[model samples]
Target: MNWKGVLDFLKEKKFGLDRKELVEAETSPVVPDDFCAEEVVYEMNDMGEREAIERFVPPTRSTATRKPPARTKGHSRGSMVDPRTNRAITFASAHEWRCALILLASPEIAEVYDQPPAITYVDAEGKKVKHTPDYLAVSRSGKKCAIAVKPSRRVEKSGIVDTLDRIKPILGDYADDIILLTELQLTHERATNAESALQAHSCRVQADCDRVAVIMSGINGEVNAYDVAKAFGDFPRGMNAIWCLVYDGIVKLANPALMLADHPFVFRVLQATSVAA
Candidate 1:
């Protein structure tokens, strides 16, 4: 066998290959986690009597070959490999680092962090359609806050106004409360502009309305203030936007695509600040 072929074989074994090398070694590999069917059978003695027959046993899977936990992979995306006790700072793009931070800063939000957020109310045909938001986390005071999370990079085109329009009704009188959470990793000006437009569209007094709060991501750990302040200091990304609806409940748009809680970073963030109340 040629030396080239030997290298290829060793690469296929994944003995010491990096992620890129392993991927390149094989164009595609069977996904290990997918489950499939296997035949199971029962055995019986010639006696043919139920009491005399030996029970058929299915093959037992060996725990040694079992898949380990997700935490085993260090440096993997969304892995909370931070050795530190408090995760006040971390980097997460897939789960949008913003979602993790809000749950970190506000121990009060962990209550409804697990629920899937959905648009509870819609105004498509001048008629209200009721829908349960993905998150209906309750406050210590028995108030309900509607939550939705997405990357600031992904908040394109679907603008916050559209999101607010659909979800504003959750802030209706009957609703104990309505809270919108937006997490974006974008420029300070862009983030502020996007957020300011959402509530400003509606007038004041009614703007300061009740049962509704718009919460936005304050700042991502990736972009340090010094890096941002070199350009726009006072205008640094608002990071978190928590607004209590006063007027008619202003409208906003929040896409649920690519959102996840299973990530370790997300899990840890929620675990750290889990709402005690």
Candidate 2:
């Protein structure tokens, strides 16, 4: 045998023997009878029934009940994986995508479901209507909230507010509350911060969190996130730790504002559980 030729062929193909070796090895090899190739039936004398043969077939699978609507000429569509639940959520429009990220970034929110099951409710017109919310969020306290995302212009033009108003009354059946989010609430700063929180969550380290917790223990009053990050002496790791702390509820924004590192926040001293070993 050509040893060099065999090694060269193996390296080139990266799998199995070459044609020459395969032909040599299988030359006159005994072939087994096709015992189970065809479906077989067993005879039962007493039962008077033939035994059934089982065939391999993949079972049908389903997770999310509703899918995002198809994109029209003026609409947008996209998807993002929620880090909290490790589930992929599809958005039919940019507004819905923004809403998902904002919800995922909140410390109180535990899980987010996009295009949740439709709920039937009567509108002000006294007619039954089936309405599907953009997203449904579950809080840490186990409260569910149905969210509707729409542009301010469209909300006025299509009278979405009236529909939401009607849906709010019966929302207690499926959710604790119904919230209508508009572009005004989904600011650029919030979107940026939410994206940062998601990224920080992916690369979080326990050691860094412990260090940040120790630093926050010494804090009393409100402080800027940038200053907190500076206290750690390592900006990147410190900021990431701060975001992790925010998600854990140890750190909270002082008011309704952007969550950038430069923004003001107050440490939640009561919820300060040690993250150390």
Top candidate, metric TM-score: 2
Please report the TM-score between candidate 2 and the true structure: 0.69
Candidate 2 residues 1-277, lDDT tens each? 5997765565534422244533443433222222122334565656787776644322122235676668899888877776556577778887777887788777778888887888888876789988888888998779999898998888888777888888887776599988889989987678777777666766677677788888887888776665666677665667778877766667766754664433446564566543211
Worst 10 residues of 2 by lDDT: 29-38
TM-score of each: 0.28, 0.69
> What lDDT does the true structure give each of the candidates?
0.32, 0.70
Instruction: Give the per-residue lDDT of model 1 (tens digit) for 117-176.
Output: 334455656776554432344444556665444445545654544655666654664345
Q: How accurate is candidate 2 locally (lDDT)?
A: 0.70
